[model samples]
Target: MKTQPATTQIGWLGIVLLLFLAACAAPPNSPTPSPVVPTQAPSPTPSPLPSPTPVARSLRLWVGEDAAALPAIQAVITNFTQASGTPITVIPKPPDALRLSVAGLSLSGEAPPDLIWADQEILAGLLADGYLQPVRASGDALPGLQTAATSQSQLWGIPITAQNQLLLLYNRSRISSPPTSSDDLITSSRAAQGGLVMVWDEPYWLVPWLYGFGGSLTAGADGPPSLNTPAMLAALNLFGELAVAAPAEVKTYRGGQRWFGEGEVGLMVDGEWALSEYRSLTETLDLGIAPLPRIPATNQAALPLISGSFLMFARDLSRDDLKPAEELAHYLEQPTTQIELALALGRLPASMEALADPRLQADPGRAAAANQARQAPGLPPTKAARCALFGIDVWLPSLLKGNLDQAETAEAMQAEAEACVTQ
Candidate 1:
């Protein structure tokens, strides 16, 4: 070990310190360093949460209901709203005005109804004009409701009520017993002229008489109607005679019910739908429901037109929106709803289960209506059936007002029906 000088050792130490500092410092030509951005592991990208389900929209329904029946209908609707937690607005409309109401729907400053109350004739016409949409309801409808509920392969409406029988309604306070035959009715009506009232303005009212006289609206399902036949002439003349004996004021179904209630009219002809109203309108006046009088001259009972009332979708209702409307219709067709309507409003439920309920089976009023239903002729639904009805309605007013005779009216009706059918 040789002895070293202190200066030499100090220099060596300084050189070692310089090398250590140089190793820590950046090279002169190197790029400037960025601030240390604490390398994040991308925060483990948060998984996306699912979107919530959208709520169903509220629905709107247009009901062609008699005024007195609206409360019962509303009650049924209320139950559905509570169960589904959705709101519904029901609009009451006249049966005759329903078509025109939809015609001006765009101009009415409101959305078209999601559901509409439809019958055989109205349903047929609406389907033809593209005013209705094919619906998702079909099952166990009354026999005559086939055409009204479906269009060949498509379901169009849900049947709620059936057995739309023409009833001979009499105010028992004025007339003790219902006449058994047309001869008896004519005699009674003539003896007390202006005591009877019938909604003769409606063509459906004439259907029973036309059939009773052995006249058909058309030879086949499609027309060229057989309006100018001898049978039609006979039916028309007899209807006219009854009209002559009827009060001019009590011509509408509502009017007849009111007049009968007031004891101003002794007898009236209407449908089973009016039973509840007639019963409600008077406590003093005993309401009687009976089958239409048999035509003595024809030796046949008046053949009533039995049908089912339905819930139909409007054309503007999207297929996507149909589920809610369909649900509402399903609710309406349920046995609970159907039975409630039958019990409250005298409607004959389309549901067989509802129809078989002990309440309905034991109801005397409904029993009489059922008897009339049994007598209804099996009139098929046809494309031209609505047209034929339109023709009659167009020309019947003229015939009743003496603006046209039976022959002229029948010929005019035939022409009108043929034109509509051809179109």
Candidate 2:
């Protein structure tokens, strides 16, 4: 059952790895950076790639970051513009919209944005469609992040932060310690003040429970439909059980946030992206962050979906158009810039050096976020995953509201997702 040789039967794997060196990570102190081919990127484009054309233009950056996070992000851009004296314009959009927007703009005859700061999950779709050019990063980013940003085993973007991770959060004022297992979480959530769990009624929040119990949205890891498994039913049942055990008073996400801050709800599930907001509540709320507790039946912790912001490039960038973007990207990767972002935004740095900096070491919350991230299976950015994630987001509410039972919900999800790929 051996596959053919590379020159004969090479699949997307070969093209993906061809974008950058096989050794994704570079030596910490390597004087020379790893070789990469932007034109040869992850897409299986025809050979005799066109030569680079010089274009004189300021870098256009489209960032998919929350409004509260823009200030810190802006500070970095300000430094880059000031240091390099390169004129740049910045625009912010929703993370989920960045990919679609970039793809649409490419087809409209308008030159694509020169740069993007977005979730790593969008890279696979972009690369699969030949919308992005691979980057020759310094390769000093955390191995976990490099892995997350890679699609089909190819590196397409440089990791900016290991920050988009879900973890169990509780208030020390209400509970002395965080729960380490599911049974404990249920008991503690019941005993906490207000006796209500601040739950996010969304699929992103349900992924860990599904994965922890061996349920999957896709068949095997290759992303075919297989949602109607016993494990999925069990996971859905577990989620319903927790929701029933602690009735929620707040109906909206913002309401839940308000309640959690007011100490009305002590336990919740949230991403590390919320660290800055929660860290500010130190005066009134003693927040504690921990990885999702292990399931007692399986003895496996829920698998967080790990991903982070990335610095990505447009496919059409000429050598001249790319210079400034590359300069800014490299500048963002520096230990100083990463450390500054870590402190100002309560984020986990992608740079190993910045992550180990003494200043960042003092923040226990960041450490907990990193621990949870380490336990994640990472957000798969494949085309199949992109399709499945959409179906998951669409079906989560029906399952949570009890409009669809576990079996019914799983079947609907499978059918809907299979339809997505087929169409």
Candidate 3:
């Protein structure tokens, strides 16, 4: 039985080998099968390319003599850079030097600042020359800016600070009730020794009188220039009276703050900024602030409001450059930054929100000034208004020297200013 089983296993193995050979063998006549090709992977859809990174460029800004304003400006610039990923360089130049530098830059067609933080009056000249780009009068770009600060139906700059020509800084010890009317101011001036010691020969200061007497630099909608009007003549007469009541040296007195702070003057017409300088004069010397006295008959409060603004000069800038500049300007106009600036630099904030700050409201003087600015009648919306208000370089100093009588001075100035407008 064992021998039979072994022989049977060999026969089974041979049978299996024959079946494998049969399976492996194929007919040569069968059409050669095409070689199987690797199926190409479905081509992947290409991804869109990313936007290019913005180029890094340096921006130079010209600012004025406010050391306190520097930190806030820097903070804004730093924040702008962080948010927009750009670089800004702020150059604080002397106020006197800024115009010359800007002029030089324009003349050479090279190296101009990307922005300028300057007095609006100065920007007026630049605007006339087409050196500035119109800010397009967008809503709230300069939230608290008066119509006077803008130009050509557009905002040329973003006003950040403002001051007025007529501020009544009085000595509290001498007078309990501050004068509310021009007649009252006159009466007080005559009663006091050394009188008011008015800071003589400031035309801007004199503008209040012109307004009080119902005169304006420019004509109303239908009227002619009012320089020679009867109201102007009366204002000049009143000013002459005030000038006579003042000290002989009043002509030489540069500012009334010194005279008022020293207790030599009873009443002074100055700006709110004078409070800081005169605060230490006397603890008992009560300091009172009020808007410039109004004309008795007309009941009009006349003030020459001066404002400063932040301007952009990068008309040729790409989006990358413009984004940061716009951001920085926006940062500077923020409520918090405006408050900080008002507190640190004694500047009035350009935003209405900043005006609501408790710190600014604490000081009745600043609060009053802020209120007056908010309500004050703004200058005309023309570059010529600036030249009319603040005569050209030579004319300003000469007029301040008090060489001509009020009539002659006003006439000469009006003519010069008109010429500047025509030119």
Which is the leading candidate under TM-score?
3
Q: Write the per-residue lDDT of candidate 1 for residues 1-423, one digit (tens) a residue.
A: 998999999999999999999998887896789888776665577889989978767677888877887899889889998998767888898888887787887799767788887566677767777888777654455555554455556777787777667788777777778898987787777665227787787888888899899887877543356788888888889888888667766656777767777778778787776666667776656777777888988888887787877788888887777677777887887887888887887668876556667888687567666655544653444566767888998999998888999899889998998888778
Cα displacement (Å) at residue 13, model 1: 17
Q: State the lDDT of candidate 3 residue by residue for 90-115, as single tens digits.
A: 88877666767676875768577787
Report, for all candidates in order, the number of backbone clashes.
0, 0, 0
Ranking by lDDT: 1, 2, 3
lDDT of all predictions? 0.76, 0.75, 0.65
Give the C-alpha miss distance for residue 265 in model 1, angstroms: 7.6
Cα lDDT of candidate 1 equals: 0.76
Error of 2 at 103 (Å): 5.4
RMSD of each: 8.1, 30.6, 10.0
Can you tell me which runs of candidate 2 are displaced by over 4 Å? 1-60, 64-71, 74-112, 121-129, 138-148, 192-196, 214-222, 248-250, 275-284, 319-331, 334-336, 401-405
Query: Superposing every Cα of model 2 onto the true structure, what RMSD results?
Result: 30.6
State which candidate, 1 or 2, has the greater TM-score: 2
Q: CA lDDT of 124 in candidate 3?
A: 57
How many angstroms is residue 1 displaced in model 2 relative to the true structure, after the best TM-score fit?
A: 99
